[model samples]
Target: MRRGTGHLMNTSVTVWRVVLADDGGGGQTEAWAPQGEQPARLSQPTARQREVGDQENAHLTHVVYLRPGVDVRRGDQLRQPGLRLEVVAVFEPSVRGTYLRADCTSRQAEGE
Candidate 1:
């Protein structure tokens, strides 16, 4: 997607990575560390269902657009207000490299 494609990216997302932290018991705990923030255009969420084992899993997927050359990787997460999106894949959707697309999955928050 181009920068001037009439899509106003007013929302900013903070990128986070899971890191191992010492728990003082010789074990490590998975914690989220903020990598950085970036301007992103969030597409409308799409819902789908997939069969896993013997149960069906429902999840939402969103396409996030960011500037070209952004170092986004799989397993990273994008955090916005009241939303957390786990990055499933990252690729350049356009041939001109104007922006990068991050395919993310959103599930219901715990205890919801």
Candidate 2:
């Protein structure tokens, strides 16, 4: 992922379906809401994460600041457990950062 290198970027965004559980107070509660799906704008390693989080993801992390129409408060999709995202966004020149690998990005969408 270097500058001026137009690699496979369009298939870079990681799309995920967010199921938000409501905080209900009754015995029969906790309804799941289908939040609008969003993508994880990926970027190259910052030299810091490369040394951390073992070597599985090695240095991959979602760039929250670059994701448009996404809430900057909390990365809801990035926080979801067992969530493997699918690549959908048509890649173009990001006015923010560079996307790295497609291993975790190019997944098929989950069955509804």
Candidate 3:
């Protein structure tokens, strides 16, 4: 998540939903969605140099669109209206004009 200087000045924050896989053997792999308001403060960022695109973008939202630990496929759900997206390809923004997409298989979301 990138924010402009102004947004940072205003104490910008967001929520991240990461999937944790279960290793079997009485273990569980559940996705974690932080409840309530949590401030996201990065002490040392992997990305140092900031650019114009570093500014706040609409794609990153305060809430997780796909939800946590939900078995989502390539043609899963979409958040934005008129926003055609897919999970088929994972894109790295640093790679220039590369667009990311994904395709969900028959995998069921853990704890779904």
Candidate 4:
């Protein structure tokens, strides 16, 4: 636990990276490879954030908080049970070593 972050991450999500694999036809196919799981706290965007996303047609949905040094990045996929979120952006606090935040969009159809 880092300072006040004790137990803040109440759940874990598996992080997946899309890799290009040889399709044996001189072409590559995108494949989802698990990058392992990490502790995370998934939250819905606030009213203001939601409004901004709506105006921009971004469909931004969840904000995921993870401990610093987690191997996550934009374009990665975060998955838990019935939900899948596509990571849109990754941010680090100015103070550093506090936590990492990921702005994500819901991929409802993929989960179905």
Top model by TM-score, which number?
Answer: 4
RMSD vs true structure, all candidates: 4.7, 9.1, 13.8, 2.1
* Candidate 4 segments whose C-alpha is farther than 4 A from its true place: 1-6
- Clashes in model 1: which pairs? none
Would you give me the overall lDDT of model 2? 0.36
Expressed as tens digits, the lDDT of each residue in 81-101 for candidate 2 is: 444433222232455354323
Report, for every candidate in turn, its global Cα lDDT versus the true structure.
0.75, 0.36, 0.29, 0.89
Which whole-number lDDT from 0 to 100 does residue 67 have in model 4?
A: 89
Candidate 4 lDDT, tens digit per residue, 1-111? 548453799999999999999999999999999999999999999989888877877678999999888989999999998889999889999878889999899987543
- Which segments of model 3 are wrong by more than 4 Å? 1-8, 26-28, 33-112
- Given candidate 4, what's the lDDT at residue 65? 93
TM-score of each: 0.70, 0.30, 0.21, 0.88
Candidate 1 structure, TM-score to reference: 0.70
Per residue, candidate 3 scores C-alpha lDDT tens digits across 14-67 of 222445677778787766443333222222112321221145321221211221
Ranking, TM-score, top scorer first: 4, 1, 2, 3
Candidate with more favorable, higher lDDT: 1 or 3: 1
Which of the numbered candidates is closest to the native, going by highest lDDT?
A: 4
Tens digits of per-residue lDDT, candidate 1, 1-112, equal 3355225666789999998999999999999899999989998544332222113222436778887777789899998878888887788864756678787778455776
